[model samples]
Target: MAEKIIKGIVIDRFNFRDFDLIVSLATNFGVIKMVARGVRRPTSKNIYILNPGCLGEFEIFLARYSNKLSKLKKGECFFNLDLNDKKIYAFWKLVSQITRETNFVPKIFPILEQSFAKINSKNADAIKVYTIINWIKFNGWIANLTRCRVCKTNQRLINFNFYGGMECVYHQNPKPFFRFGRKELEIFYWSSSNLNTFLEKVDFDYIYLVFEILKQFLKQNSYIFL
Candidate 1:
């Protein structure tokens, strides 16, 4: 067997037999689970590089069996997210979970890499919203927010639909499971229009609420969520 070098970010890790670790790495090739033999030991050289949020180039040994995960030999970290911060860690955990659960969609790794680069304290929440929006769009779940899917009118756009059309929640004829008001409507408008303006103007409270709902919707669609 020959050593193969690959570059990726460590999305997650689980301890194996007290001394080893199984790492989920998001790479250009897609997410792959590899065994980091003896990484749980304090003296292991790959310990820091094989943990979550670490972006590194790894040398691995390909498994002889397709069902078995490859072996993580050694690696060097190029960037590392500060997992010590609970909020930031939670955000990243959601991202990794999405990668783990969602089917292999083309170009998602690049989007994830771009998303990680955009996150910071100053614009973390905004970036998170933006990233989720992209994920929703990429997975073909985002519906038209500019107008009513049935009536084809932008007026009274209050209800949410996960299947591609949104109805009004205020009307008595039919009730919608996920609905939004004028404020949320405005947020969705900017989300569809200008991204920069959306990030700059989105209210924290509304963004948080919308984020939660969107995440739930993703979960309902068999995607990943926090």
Candidate 2:
């Protein structure tokens, strides 16, 4: 078989014994796993390129027996990414944890790259929130907040159901779910707008509100709590 090269970001990695590793990467092609031999040794040059959030090109050998796994032969870093900030570090950790292993999404790689670029800037927290919101949207996990999920009419929705969506006061259930009002709607509107412009207008506080709503939305849809 021929060698395959791919550009991707290291999203997660695991140490195996003394000098080997199992790495999980997100590329335009999809999420992939590979084995890196001797990377943990003190003289290894591949260590920097294998860290989570490092965007790079990987040269791998495709084993004839199993195409699902690859042997990492070489790695080249695309950019020097700063992952030392605790906030940025935490965000990447969460991303690695929630992302499904072996699932392929063509759009995920570019989005991850753009997100890391933004978070590396001075407005790291705000961009982190933006990235999370975009992640949810890219995955199609959001519910329509502008109209009623049942009646298909635009109204002031007062409640949200995990299975259903936004409900008007007349249609809402007594049990606890999510409650929305004018303020929440405004936040949703802002979140849906252009990210660059939206970041200029809203601070982290407002973004956090929207983030919490998105978190709940994700929980109901995928049963995964972020």
Off-target runs (Cα >4 Å) in candidate 2 are 16-18, 63-68, 79-83, 102-106, 143-187, 190-195, 201-203
Candidate 1 C-alpha lDDT tens digits along 111-220: 55655665666666666676666666667865675666666676766765656545554432354556676666566656664456666666666777878777777677
- Model 2 residue pairs with clashes: none
Per-candidate alpha-carbon RMSD to the true structure:
4.6, 4.3
Consecutive 10-residue window with the lowest summed lDDT within model 1: 168-177
Instruction: Give the candidate number with the greatest lDDT.
Output: 1
Q: Candidate 2's C-alpha lDDT?
A: 0.67
lDDT of each: 0.70, 0.67
Residue 11, candidate 2: Cα error in Å is 2.0
**Deviating ranges (above 4 Å) for candidate 1:** 1-3, 17-19, 101-106, 143-162, 165-205, 223-225
